[model samples]
Target: MRTAKFWMGTLLAGALALGYGCGSDANKDPTPQDVPQQQVPDAGADAGVVLTLTDAQIARVLQVANEGEVMLGQYAAPLATDQAVIDFNNQMVTEHTAVKQRLDALLAAEGITPEDSPLSLQLQAEVQQLMDVLQGPNAPAAGAALDLALLSAQLNAHARTAFIGDSLLTPQATNTALQQELASERQAVQTHINEASDLQSVIVLPPVEP
Candidate 1:
């Protein structure tokens, strides 16, 4: 549980740092930029749907990520037995809920309604798959198996999120505010990865029965 405490504290510190001196000169309405026609993950399934996303589309995808984390955290809470894992789940729920609220406020202030894209839809599907794995009839029991599963899922999810933030969202951001926000988000996701990795180190899963 100490690691859980440290993870929450780190996230809080990062959020405060972001809020302290980063908002004075940001553009309220960031202009949308044209990204080159590139293939996103699962692009082949969509065929001709180029992932040249607008700021609104990026926001929508970000919202999906945030919401997915919140859902995963909530679902894991009752099923997790390890104190550290439980703490992690609670903190994720808290931070992601707060982050989503802030994002919603930002979008409202800018009079921007996030627009969905093929990327966002694909992400939604991926998140749902994770949820199914946890919630389905064959879900792992509430112990080391569950803990390992949750940690592994978070590791993969956050890594992908950080990659998207760095490779796609930040570069496509035309608004200084959105860029700054995305930078902060990327940092937070990295922190999550670190914490998840640490938790994974301490968990010992049972050997599979052949």
Candidate 2:
């Protein structure tokens, strides 16, 4: 449950920050952008992969990506003591949540209920295992490490997701919210990766100039 708090707290803090920072727009379009049109996936990748995803497929993808991104943001939020890292984490959470909202609107237009991804469901299971570990003696450092890794993966995962969403949903005419969200996410992840890289350095002394 404490682990759960880690995830939820990140989301809550991020939303609060977003709401206070710029104020989310429920009605405004994400903004106009030049996203490439959707393309069909590789035919050789999988036998059962559908070429043209239904509206349902789109919705499911959005739902999982949003929730996962939030969880990822939450996981990353407290991992860094640096201000940049914290800001980046907050940016990721805010953007993804906005994406989730946009996707939700699209889904409701079709009267759909989004389902969690099998991949995310598996992650949740792993989270459960992590929670078990956190409850025991491995709670402190192990838990902290777990959040770091998860958020790192989230940044990468979100990149792929952005590509996939652009391809599948064809967000050519995004509103101000979606556009800003995309920009924020792209920037946040890049910043987060840099910060994480700095933190992970071995701290070797500089080589003497020959």
Candidate 3:
């Protein structure tokens, strides 16, 4: 009975973790026949979306999001026409660069880069796996869709600023800075999703290039 109870508990923990990882709303990306997303227009121009990513958090955010964008573009090349790919490519570049710019401004104001170590490497490895699948033969459509959804949730949960910016407005020694930083990151994640959705629209041209 003890052994059985242990297994049951472990199973329950795993299930909860999986649910959280996939997102509370499994239906968030509903598309026809499980394709995950409806046809989105080719993202027209860089001006189409504006996200506020500060320079303080730019490097890490870039490291993660860029890898994700690259994986998405390469792995799912067949999903969108060439023009749509180009549009997505442009959007990714624009929004990510904007993140860099904002971070740069913040850095000049406050002289620090947040601590990042093995975490960045871990994320890079995951991106490379997705890339390999894309660049590899026999890559299935199902795998690509699953990877995109997983990465979307991961990025959404990550921090936006190197340090919370709210404390900065207070005194230099106050603890509230961390909270402000977290809030800023949360906001940045929302902006990223909106821009990504916008870019998804324009990729529906006939015979989307792989």
Candidate 4:
């Protein structure tokens, strides 16, 4: 049961990180830009793999990518004591921020404004719950326990985000630019997952009291 709880906590923390940090006004109207329209190439030709995704799915992808950055980006400051974790956190923030920008540009090009999905809301709730626990009195101390919590959460979050990028967004996205961005983001997320796992392996948690 403890193991299950720990895994669940990490999963929720990840979902929260992905869903949080999205601005409340993200769904607001986008200012018109004079961006040139790149024609979506034929799926069979130059396009490697093309999946037809609805505008809503594209927007959800944008939301997740954008919010995920915000969540991970905020970690460096709080976990700054550990140089390794800080370095990893900073890298994630940079990579995710770039991906978010790319997703925003893609949305603008497609003239599809982003909106929050039901899934996003659910993720946000889960994250909020995790945050509550972290802030509670019984929360882990500011060393291995805290590091493990953050790392574990980020690991699960990256894994989930990578799955979405690979399985859901990449396959269904028709835009060449979006596809390229997803491919790169997917690779980056995988890298983070591996790094987080490696870090987690070395963290020696304090023994639990009976």
Query: Highest lDDT, which number?
Result: 1
Q: What is the C-alpha RMSD of each candidate to the true structure, in Å?
A: 15.1, 14.8, 13.8, 16.2
Q: Estimate each model's TM-score.
A: 0.73, 0.44, 0.43, 0.63
Stretches > 4 Å off in candidate 4: 1-53, 205-210
Which stretches in model 2 have alpha-carbon errors above 4 Å?
A: 1-52, 115-151, 166-210
Q: Which residue pairs collide, candidate 1?
A: none
| CA lDDT, every model vs. true structure | 0.65, 0.43, 0.38, 0.53
At residue 81, candidate 1 shows an lDDT of 88
User: Residue 41 in model 4: shift from native, Å?
Assistant: 40
Sorted by lDDT (best first), the order is 1, 4, 2, 3
Query: What's the C-alpha lDDT at position 108 in model 4?
Result: 86
Q: What global local distance difference test value does model 3 have?
A: 0.38
Q: Which of 2 and 4 is ahead in lDDT? A: 4
Instruction: Specify the poorest-scoring 10-residue window by lDDT in model 1.
Output: 29-38
> Residue by residue across 96-208, what tens digits does model 3's lDDT show?
55655665555455665643333343345545554554444433354434334333322322211111222221123222443354355446645544444433332222236
- Candidate 3 off by > 4 Å: 1-79, 82-86, 140-182, 194-210
lDDT of 1 at 28: 16
